[model samples]
Structures are given as structure tokens and as C-alpha cells.
Target: MSETVVSVRDVNIYQGSNLVLQDVNFNINRGEFVYLVGKTGTGKSSLLKTLYGELPLREGTANVAGFDLKGMNWKKVPFLRRNLGVVFQDFQLLTDRNVHQNLRFVLKATGWTDEKLIEEKINDVLDKVGLKSKGFKMPFEMSGGEQQRVDIARALLNSPKLILADEPTGNLDPETSDEIMQLLFQICKDYGTAIVMATHDFIVINRYPSRMLKTERNRVLDSAVPA
Candidate 1:
């Protein structure tokens, strides 16, 4: 059976009072790798925000990682986030912390109380991202690719069902981007985690094609749909 990680139906996304995307509908299944592509100001960010519960979904029936987006509130947002991971273009690691402490901080904030379990989880993610030995290094001491790996490792700490990656390879060189892309695809396959990556890199898309969801003309276009 195919499991849905994100489902948006009859949605109208907005930024403040401005309608950003209209009639958006899509379903992303578990272990699927989907690319979200759009030009600047084409409502891609709005759609991502809605999926992650950062922006209120006032005009749609959508579910992300089994949480009803329409019913999301400030109190429920944290719980919803626990089931999802978000990766950014910029490796948003704290400058003062090493990789281990950075990962530990996220686990603690998300309510992991057992020290032994936390240590194990951190180790697990670092190993997955090919950074097992670099956990003691500070973010500034690492290369762009390594920092991005730590960011990915941090995202995996909660074992989320869906990962929302915003331009995850935007900051790296072509070679480094390839490495990150491979790691992302590996994670999706190995863990059965769904990924929705928003990117403007057409070169990356051509190199590693998959299902694509494009935001254009105030609407979302799915490549799965026939013209």
C-alpha cells in the first residue's frame, strides 16, 4: 500500500492577505523524492510554509505527516514539527556548538530526556550522513559539504517521516551538490522517508530526475499530470 506523507486538496495559499497559490493539489507518498520548482515570487515558499505549519492553511484541506494542516495552531505546531524535518540552503548550525552538541540541542528541544538514547540517535544520524568522525568539529572548521551533512544529520535526529528541504544544495559546488543529492536519495530509499525539495537548480534536476511539482501562474503543476 502506498502511504501518503503530504496531501493538499483545493488549497489556496496566501501570504498575509495576498493569495499566492490557487487550487493547489498534490499527494506525495512515502519514500518518494519530489522536486518543487518555481521561479522567484511564484508561491513556492508559501506552499512549503503551509506544508510545515509555519503559515496558516486557511483555505484548504491538507494533511502533512498525518497532521491536519487546516486545524493547525500555535500549540499544536510543535507536535506537528516532530513528525517532519526541514533542511535549509544555509547550514544553520550554531557557531558556538560542535556538531554533536548541535544535534544534541535539537533532540533536547524536541523533548528527548534520556542521555543514552540521545547519544545513540546522534551517532546514528552522523553515520548516515558520512560524518561519524567529524561530530567533534565546529561548523566553521568544516567544509561546506560537511556542514551541509551536519545539517542533514540534524534533520534526521527525530527520524521524521517527511523532510522539507529548501535549496539543500544551493550553496555547494557541483561536485558537492552531487554528493548531497546522492545522500538525500539514499536517505529516502533506505528509511522510507518522503522528501519535498524546493530548488531552482535545473541542472541538478536534469541530472537526477524524479517527480516534479512546479509553482507557476498562481497554481501548482504536477509532472505526474498529463497535459
Candidate 2:
């Protein structure tokens, strides 16, 4: 049976007091790679925030990584996030820490206590992102691409079932963006992790086509199921 990693139905997304998206409906399955594309201020970020519990899901029946979005409290948001990985446009790595320390800090905050296990998991994710040898390097020591890799490694720390990637390739060059795209698709195929990536790079989207969800005129239009 195919598993639904994210299901949003009749969702009304808000930013502050404005209704950004209305009556949104979509279903993302395990191992699926879906692209979220739209112009700025079209509710792409708002929708992504809703999925990862950054924005409140009001007037909707939505479930993400098995967590119901309705009535989600601040205390419960972290638990919901534990099962979902979020990638930002700007790689939000701690500048004060090296790659390994950055990853370890996330693990520790997420309740990981065993030192040996943390080390092992760190290596595994680093290896997955092709940065196994750069764990000791500081964030400033790496290139934008390398730093982005570290960000991806951090996202994998929890072995999350779903990843909400917000413009993951927004800051990279063509070559580096291609590399990140390959890595992301590989993760989805290899680990059965569903990915919902928000991007405005049409070159990358056209280069690597997948199911697309476009945010236009206060609604989400799915290319897979044409309206």
C-alpha cells in the first residue's frame, strides 16, 4: 500500500492575518518527489510553513508525517517537526560551529543522548551528502555548495519521513544546484523519503521534471491532476 506522507485538504493558509492560500488540496506519497513552483508572495512559503508547523493550519484538515495540523500547539509543534525535515533557502548553519558540531547540536537538542550513537549517525548522514571528510571544517571554510550539503546532512539527522525543502537550490550556481538536485532525488529513491521542494528555478525544474504544485492566485494548482 502506498503511504501518504503529506495530505492537505481544504486548507486555508495564513500569514499574520492575511489568507494566503485557500481551499488547497493535495496528497504526497512516500518516496515521491514533488516540486512547488510559483512567483514570490504566492503562498509557496506560507504553504511550506504550514506543512512543517511554522504556520498555523486553520480552516483545513491536513496531516503531515502523521501529525494532524489542526489544533497543533507550540509544545506539540516540535514533535511534529521531529518527523519532518525542513531545508531553508539560506543554509541556516551555526557559524560558530564546525560541520560535525552543528549536526551534533541538532541531535542533542532533539533528545539524542548516547555519544557513540550520535557520532555514528553524524557520519552516516555526512556520507549520504558526500561530505564525510569535511565534518571537521567550519561553515565559513566551505563553499556555498559544501555548506548546503552540510545543511542537508543536518536535515537527515532524524531520519525524517518527509522533507519540506524551501528553495534548497535558490542560492547555488547551475552546477551546484544540479548536484543538490541529484542528491535530493537520490535520497527520495534510496530511503523512501518523500520530498516537497519549493523552488523558483525553472531551469532546474525543466531539467529535472516531477509532479508540480503551483501557487497562483490564492490557490494551489497541481499539474498531476489538472483543474
The TM-score leader among the candidates is 1
What is the total number of backbone clashes in candidate 1? 0
**Pairs of residues clashing in candidate 2:** none
Cα distance off (Å), candidate 1, residue 109: 0.1
Give lDDT tens digits, candidate 2, residues 1-227: 89999899988888888989999999999999999998998988888888888888879799899999997989999999889888888999999989999999999999999999999999999999999999999999999999988888888899999998989998999999999999999999999999999998999999999999999999999998956
- TM-score of model 2 vs. true structure: 0.98
TM-score of each: 0.99, 0.98
Q: Model 2: how large is the Cα RMSD against the reference? A: 0.8
